[model samples]
Target: MATNLFQRFKTDISGIELPEKFTFPFYYEPHILSKIAAQELQNYLQSQTDFEHNFGLEENQKGLIIGKMFGVLVCQNKEGELGYLWAFSGKLANVNHLPYFVPTIFDMLHEDGFFRKEEEILNSINRQIEFLENSDELRTKEIQLQATKIEAATDIQNQKNKIKRLKIERDEKRNSFTNLSLSENGTSNCELVKQTLEHELSEESKRESILLKKMTKYWNFQIMNAQKEVDLFLDKINSLKEERRQKSGTLQQKLFAEYSFLNLYGERKSIGEIFDNNPPAGAGECAAPKLLHYAFNHQFKPIAMAEFWWGQSPKSEIRKHKQFYPACKSKCEPILLSHMLKGLDMYANPFQENPAEGKEIEIVYEDEILLVVNKPAEFLSVPGKIITDSVYQRVKKLYPNATGPLIVHRLDMSTSGLLLIAKNEEAYKQLQSQFIRRTIKKRYVALLDGIINKNEGVIELPLRVDLDDRPRQLVCYEHGKFAQTRWEVIAVENNKTRVHFYPITGRTHQLRVHASHELGLHTPIIGDDLYGTKSNRLHLHAECLTFMHPISKEEITIQKAAEF
Candidate 1:
């Protein structure tokens, strides 16, 4: 009776809910199960030893339906839920296989009970489909409403834009009439105003142009007049200078009354006492007047004329004066005193002796190691035949016993003061090293062409000799050795500046080149010629030298004043 009922229920359920390909139960646990676990069970049956070759598991709301052999096994389980998993094995499409249970669990449920439960699952799934269809219809209506609202808003904006455009057109037409009337009135007024402005501007420009022309002409005339006045001033100054020179010439003659060699050597009265009697009445006829006249006529000579002046002297006295004809060719003269005193105030003094030549020329400082002297501007530092009668010759003559007084360094011919000489070879070597190493310090005084802007400053530049000219140097950026100098302004007078220059390097003509070329100053050292105006003289003066003493092995500093 129970088997008949089970078969009857299966026939009824199969007929009522048969799918075209498959059928599934309506159960929450089966629909929500992980797809991975369902697939794992499907794969397991395909490879198992008791499983037949034709096998398949279809996932549905009942978790999975296992179809193998000739029967199906349906399972119900949630995630993390445990259930007895059954495998059905029988003749599927006329084939047979062994039936098994997972984890060794078995179930003995009839198809009558399973069919009854499956019917309820199908009914529940039908209700969910109906609800989803109704919700989709409502969502479609909401989307259509939103689209309609957007289109209506866009049409309203277009209408507003059209109205604004029409209003603007109407306003433009209305303003055209009013604007035309105003433009007519404004045009008439503006034309009149424009004509009046143009007339005013033309008249003002004409007046300004005329005034500018007159001012330009006036300025030009003033410039020419000023130039003429300057020329006249310079002419007057030159004239006055020449007039002064003439008067000075006559005055010099009267002061330095001519010395007669005949009178000087033959007479018992000294040249000083003879001048005390009988003063000359005229400027040209003083007792010393002939001395100036003789100097004006004679060439440069160191000694007096032997036949006229020194012929009467005793042989011993002549020898004492170094007066041998061939050996002592240097000439002495009375005029030499006047020539020597040319720039001194004592030229006009009546009572002056011929400067002594016999006295040993003084060495300002001398030791076994070093010798320092006040070198005269016109004297050479080293002895040679030409200017051999120099400071060096005088030094050697004074210190005849000393060995090899080498000239460690030298000042220029026209540069004066503080010449250093080495007494021995070792001192010479040491001093030369100091010079080469740039350890010795030197200071000079210069009279510049114009007042410099700064009171004190330094000039650091590279220097190189001029390739075109032998004795000149140029500022070379590409290839040159470094040189530096420090300068301080001493005083300013009539735009002429007195400066003290300290050279850090012993470059030839470094300071003069910097002052004139690099500085664009045209500042010539009072008498410098190469970096100065053509009429200038070399006006550099060595005023100081400081270094370690060669022999004393102590610090030595020397200073002197420039000869004006």
Candidate 2:
């Protein structure tokens, strides 16, 4: 009967067949609920070209823009009837508009209360900051004076060099006198010439020193006074900024305290309690979560959820218009995870099980210090939260006497590759040091979803976790760690490209992000579950590894070519 509830709902959109259920956390296809919601959003956004599908990108730029995500919450109200609620990434455009979307978490447009008065002051402060920043006369003067000082310093140096050249010529003339024939009383001709030159050089040196002092004093006085004025303005700007920050923090805490959330298990907590570990910034503020939160609180039964992007793509991210993206992991995962109703069917991950449990592991190389084995695809290199069966446990069962961390470096569960295991503490420490010191070389062979034009290049994109969505990474310039990847195209087959990846820094999902990100390779790896579409398995393999032997100190390189 529960399954039939979802089956009963079908749209008149002729050729488009939505999936029976929604996407899971790790794997999924879209449901009809999402499609219907997307259609509505598309129709609405088309009327307002200014509305953004992207939630956060509100800056000016040039390029073809893609859309951001908007979601729908399908639920049964108190009458046991099904209807859907709509929401956007950050906020909505014109809540009063027709087609009647769900209300945002907080009534930001409320004319009365603390939100209005305090927000007015905040806006005023922001204007002041903008005005001061745009005032560039003082800054321009500082630059101009700096140029003057550079020119002055250059002139002084050139003058001193000329004096040195004169001194060298004088020394040569004196030396020639020693080898010259003496005139009358063995005296050199033009003795007065040497005295004249010496006097001239002395005058020039004195002039150079005096000019240097005067110039230094002049520039220092001007520059220091200019800098002091600039500092004064900056101090005012910073003070106002601090005030705004404190006020914003207070407002958020107040709001969080006021709002409460409910879960399917009949458990409930105020937004503040749920965010006890970290202060809420953008969490639970998203449209889908907000809609769900409202339904569960009002005693509605939720059946399905779907979100779609409807605006131009942000310049920084690769978002396509009308493309359906799952609910973000950064902002919504924790809230939804604890809050989703229990009866709803959740998606499942295949890798959550030990696919290689009964399968054989091939030993590529072995010794007393360590063992190098070819890790099979779908086999986790180490134990995970759900899957306890892994290469570590397998090796531990075989060699109970082994010491230290067995896994030197880990491979993703979906990837098959060469894994190095240390037999003892010394070997483990030694092998880890090689990785830390970057002496170890690793190469990944992957098939990409698109053809790459460049033969070889280096990708330097900073990365940070998308706070709204868990496990999904975004190209973030701020609050991001440095990640670099070097790649060379190996070949192209079936309109697909293959490349060898050389990662310079080890960030989680670095290779995947760098490959798919528009700023990086702009090629999604074939079958990548997180950054790209789902497939039988991720088309990535840690095909080669090179490191030093702990005891023998010999350089060892192992290769396991990808089967695909």
lDDT of each: 0.47, 0.71
Cα displacement (angstroms), candidate 1, residue 102, comes to: 99
Top candidate, metric TM-score:
2
- For each candidate, how many residue pairs have backbone atoms clashing (under 3 Å)? 18, 20
> Which lDDT tens digits does candidate 2 get at residues 1-564?
122212222445456543454355334455666567557656656576644333333566443343446777666666765555666655554342223455455665678867778889889999988887777865675676677667666766776676677668757766665455344355555566557756876776677667667766776776677667677778888998999899888877777776566676566665677667464576666766666766665776666676666555454455545655666665565666655544556666454656876776788889988998888878878887888888999999989999988899888777788898999988999999998898899999999998999999999988887655556677878878998889999999998999999988888788988898778887788878676666787899888999989998899999988988
lDDT of 1: 0.47
| lDDT top scorer | 2
TM-score, one value per model: 0.34, 0.66
RMSD, model 2, all Cα superposed? 11.2
Error of 1 at 43 (Å): 99
Give candidate 1 misplaced runs (Cα > 4 Å): 1-362, 383-390, 534-537
Candidate 2: where is the Cα deviation over 4 Å? 1-27, 43-67, 75-83, 93-99, 117-254, 262-269, 294-301, 310-323, 340-360, 466-470, 476-479, 552-554
